[model samples]
Target: MQAEIEKLIVKFLNRTISNEEEALLEKWLANPVNEHVFHDYVQVHYAISMDCIDDLRLEQSKDRLILPEIEKVRSLDHNVKPKGFSIKPYLKYAAVLLVVGGGILLLLSKANEMENPVEVVSESEVIIAPGTDRAILTLEDGSQINLENDSIYEADGVKASRAMITYNATKGKISSEVQYNYLTIPRGGQFYVELADGTKVWLNSESQLKYPKNFILGETRKVELVYGEAYFDVSPSTEHQGSRFKVVNEDREIEVLGTKFNVKAYKDDINALTTLEEGLVRLDVDDEEFVIKPGQQVDVNKLTHEASVKYVDVASEVAWKDGVFSFKGKPLKEIMKTLSRWYDVNVVFEDKSLETVRFNGVIRKDKKLEDVLGIMKSRKINTYRIENKTIILN
Candidate 1:
C-alpha cells in the first residue's frame, strides 16, 4: 500500500495523473505517518535541487544527502537482484527519473504555496456611529442617578463630583452586602464611574448601570449593566488576588479578571461586543463560553449563537471615557444619534438623502450642538430649525 501510494504521489507531482488519482493520493497521505513521509520526500528533493546539500556540507562540513544509498537501488537491473530484498522490476531508469522529478516538483509546489501573497481590501466607510445620552446608574436603594446631569450629590456616604461618585476602601475591606445600585444613561448622554476596588467604567447612551454601594473586600466585585455600552479599566487586586468584574446584559454575562476592556451590549442592538484592551476576558452566552485575549474583540450575536474574534484598536473602543466624540467614517444616521444625545435633542430627517452621508472627525463634548451641526451642514448635510428640543435634518 505504501509503495502504491508513493507511485500515485509521484504521478500527481509529475502532472501525469488525473484529478481522481490526485484525490486518492491526497486521501492516503492524510494520515499522520504518511504525511510525514510525504513531507520528508519533498524536503529531500528540495535539498538536492537547490544544491543545499553542498551548502550544508560547507557550513557544517558533515551533513550530506547520502545519495549513494538511493543510487545503489537505482543501479540494480531487472534480473540482477539480491535474494529476499530486491529492486528487480521497480528500479528501472524511467522509475528513477520519475521519482527525482516528482520530488523536485513537490518541493517547488510547497514553496510556492508558502510564498502566496495575501489580498487586502482598501479601507471602507464606517457603518455605525457613536451614541450620546449614554447610560445612567441607579442604586438598589431606589435612587436614580443621571450620569449626564451636572448636579452634585452623595451615594453610600460618598460625594459625587462632576457626575461621578467616589468611594474610598483604602482603610479597610469593602463590605459585600451588595447595596445594589443601578446605572442608566439616556439617549443623549454618557457617563463613567470608579468602583470601590479601583475598577473604572464608562457607560454609553441609553444604558443602565446596577452595582453595589461598595465592593466586599474579600468577595468578587460584581456589577450588572442592564443594557448599554461600557468600557472597563480594572485594577489588579492587592497580593495578586485579582478582581473579578462581570457585566450582565440580559442572559449574557461578560466576565473579566483584572483586565482593561470594553463591552458594548445595547438592548436594541442585535449583537454584543467585548473588546479587550490589555488583559483577558470571558464571554458567556446561553451556557457557552469564549475566551478573548488582549487587542482582540469578541462579537457575539444575541439572536444567533454565533461569535467571532477580530483585531481592533483599543484606543478607539474606549475613547468616550476621555470626553471626546470620535467617529471613524460613520454614516449620517449614526452620527445624528450621537449628536442627539450630547445636545439633549431629538433628530428628525426630512429626507432620507442625509442618511447616506458619512463623516469622520472628532468633536469635543463641551462644544455646542449648533457648532457641530454647522460643521455637518458645511458638508451639504444641513440641520435646520430647532423646535421643542428637536433638530430637523434637511
Candidate 2:
C-alpha cells in the first residue's frame, strides 16, 4: 500500500499520473498530513545533493523556486500570530520547483519506498501514528458507547453516525429536564458533535465535554468542557428566542449570545483559555468578568484567578479543527504538550533548558510520528529519543 501510494505521489509530481491514479492521489492528499509527506519527500530528496539543507531559505522570485531552511527563529506561543512568516508562498515555490525541475529533480520510484529520505531513530522503537476520530460517549444513565463502533446507536435521544453525533434541536422545544451526556475523547483521538441547541463542536484529542441532552427553552444553553480542548460554533440566540449559551470549564465560565469560540482547559494545566473567532463572548473568572470581542482570547490563571485578554490569530486556536497544526514561534515545551495529547506520547526533557527552544512551522496533524519529528529535525531543533510511548529530548 505504501509503495503504490508513493508511486502515485511520484506520478503526481511528474505530472504523468493517469486519471484513476490522480483520483487516488487526491484521495490520499485529502488528508493535510499527506500533503506534508508529499513535500517531505521532495525536500529531503532535494537536500541530498544541495549542501544548503540545514540553512535552507526559500525565495520565490519570478516563479522560480529557491529551497533554503531558515535556521534561527524566536519562540512563539501556540496562539501567537506569525508576524513575518508566510508558509503559503513557500509551499507554492516548492510546487513550482517540482514541475519546472532545475535539472536535479529525481522523482522517486516504487523501489524508493523501502528507503526514506529521512530516517527514524528511536530506542525500543514505538512507531506512534497520529490521532484519529475515536471517542467514548457516556449517557446520563452511565451507559458507555464507543463512537468508533460502526453501528447506529441512539443515546439520550441523540443519534450517533460514525464520526459525528447529532441532536436534532429544531424538532421542537426542549423539555425542562436536563440530562447530560459526556463525550470523552481519549489520547490520540478526536470527535465532532452537534448539540441539541444547534451548536457544533469539534473536540480535539484528549478532550471531554459534558453537555445537556437538550437545551431548555427560555433558559441558557450550557455545556462544560471537563478537560482538554474544543472548538464551538454556537447556534444563534435568536433561534431559541433570546436564550444565551454558556460554557463552564473548571474555574472559568464563558457566556455567549451567538458566537464561535475555541476553548482549551486541560486538567493538568494551570490556565484555562477561550479564543473567540466570531461574534462575542463574556468571560467570568472568579471575581472578574469581561466582554471579549472577536479575534480576542481570554486566559484565566487558575491560581490567581487573573483573567488576561489579548488579540490573537483565530486560526492558531482553531487550526486543529481544520486538520492542521499551526505554530508560530512556539516554545519546545508548549509544542510538545500539544503533540503529546494528540500523539499519545510522553515528552520528556533530559535537560530542561531545551524547553525554551522556539519553533515556527505549520504541520499536518495526521502525519505519522516519525515524519512529524523529521519536520522538526529539519528545523534544527532535532534532539530527541523515542522509547516506547515516551519521547525523550536530550
Candidate 3:
C-alpha cells in the first residue's frame, strides 16, 4: 500500500476526492496490480468500520460509485451532482462501495485469466479460493480415484470426461455380479455423472451418489444419493425397456416416473426438499406416498418425518446446476449454510437473530466469496468478518 494512495483512499472515503484525483484513482484501478492494492486498502478500512454499512440504499450508492464514468454521465440529470459519497458505519460502507460487489475479485480474475491472477489479501493471510470441479470416486474394489476438470479417468465401463463421468451403456457392460461405485463431491466441489441407464445427475457440493458402473437389463435401474443434493434428468425408463428408476436417500425415496427433479437432503438440513422440473416423481416416506407435480416442491421434515408439497420457482431451485446461486426471500442462516458448503468456509453468527433476515438475489457461484459478501453488504443484509476459514457474521 502506498502512502499517497492511502491518503487518497481516506479522502475518497470521506467523499472529498476532487474530479482530477478521481480520474487519477480510476486510472490507477484500471491496472490489475493497482486493483488488488486498492482492494487491500478497502479490506483494512472496512474491517475497522464494520458497524455502519448501509442496507439496500448503500448498495445502490456503491454500485453508482463503481459504474464507469460513461454510465454515470449517461444516468445523471442536469441538476444532480456526481453520486460519490461516504459509505457509513463499518467497511460495510466501504465494503459494498470499495470492495463488496462480491463479484469484484471474480470479475477481475475473469478479466485477466492468467495462470495466476492476484487475490484480495487480508492481513497477509490468504482467503479460501473459490471451489472448482473436483471430487473422489471409489470403485467397488475400494480403489480411490481423484477427479479433476483438466483430466479424464476410466475404469471398467465408465469414462470420466473433463466435465463428467459417462458409462457406455451400448456396450451392455454385463458382469458376473453388480459392482457398485461411489462418487463423493466434497464441500466446495461439484461434478457431473451420466449413468449407464442414460440418466444424467448433477452432483452439488458436499453430495454423494452410489450407482453401479453398468445397469443390468431386465433389472430395476437405481442410484442412491446417500446424502446431500443432486439434480437428476432421467433417460426415461421406456428406453431401458420400462426398467424402474429409483433415487433413494435415507428415509425418503423417489420413484422416477420418467422425469427430471432435484433432491436436496443434506445431512445438516432439517428438510429434505424435492423440487420437480419435468415429468413426475413419487415421494415415499416410510410407507406413505405422495406424487409431486411440475413446478411443485415437496418439503419432508427429516426430524419429524412429516411431508408437504407446494409450488415454487423452478429456476431458482435449479440455478446452481446452471452456474448461478439463485434465492428468493431465503433466510440468512440458510443462505450462509449454502455458501459455506460451496466456499468451504464455516459461518458463525455473532447476532443470532440476524439469521432470519430474508434476502433474494442471483449470484454466480464462481465469484469469490468476498464479492458475493459485498453484494450482501449493500443489502445492509448483515455485518461480519473473515478469520481464516471462519466467517464471523454480526
Cand. 1 TM to true fold: 0.59
Ranking by lDDT: 3, 2, 1
When summed lDDT is taken over every stretch of 10 residues in candidate 3, the lowest stretch is: 105-114
Regions of candidate 1 where Cα sits further than 4 Å from its true position = 1-140, 144-151, 154-157, 170-176, 238-240, 378-385
lDDT of 1: 0.57
Angstrom error of the Cα, residue 258, model 1: value is: 1.1
User: 1 or 2: which has the higher TM-score?
Assistant: 2
User: What TM-score, over all chains together, does every model reach?
Assistant: 0.59, 0.71, 0.71
Two-way lDDT contest, 1 vs 3, winner: 3
Which candidate, 1 or 2, has the higher lDDT? 2
Q: Tens digits of per-residue lDDT for model 3 on 107-134? A: 1111112222223222223456777888
In model 2, state the lDDT of residue 236: 95
- Worst 10-residue lDDT window for candidate 1 reads 101-110
* Superposed Cα deviation of residue 134, candidate 1 (Å): 11
RMSD of each: 22.2, 12.5, 14.5
Q: Per-residue alpha-carbon lDDT of model 2 for 123-175, expressed as tens digits?
A: 12456788888889888899888877575687446789558889876556667
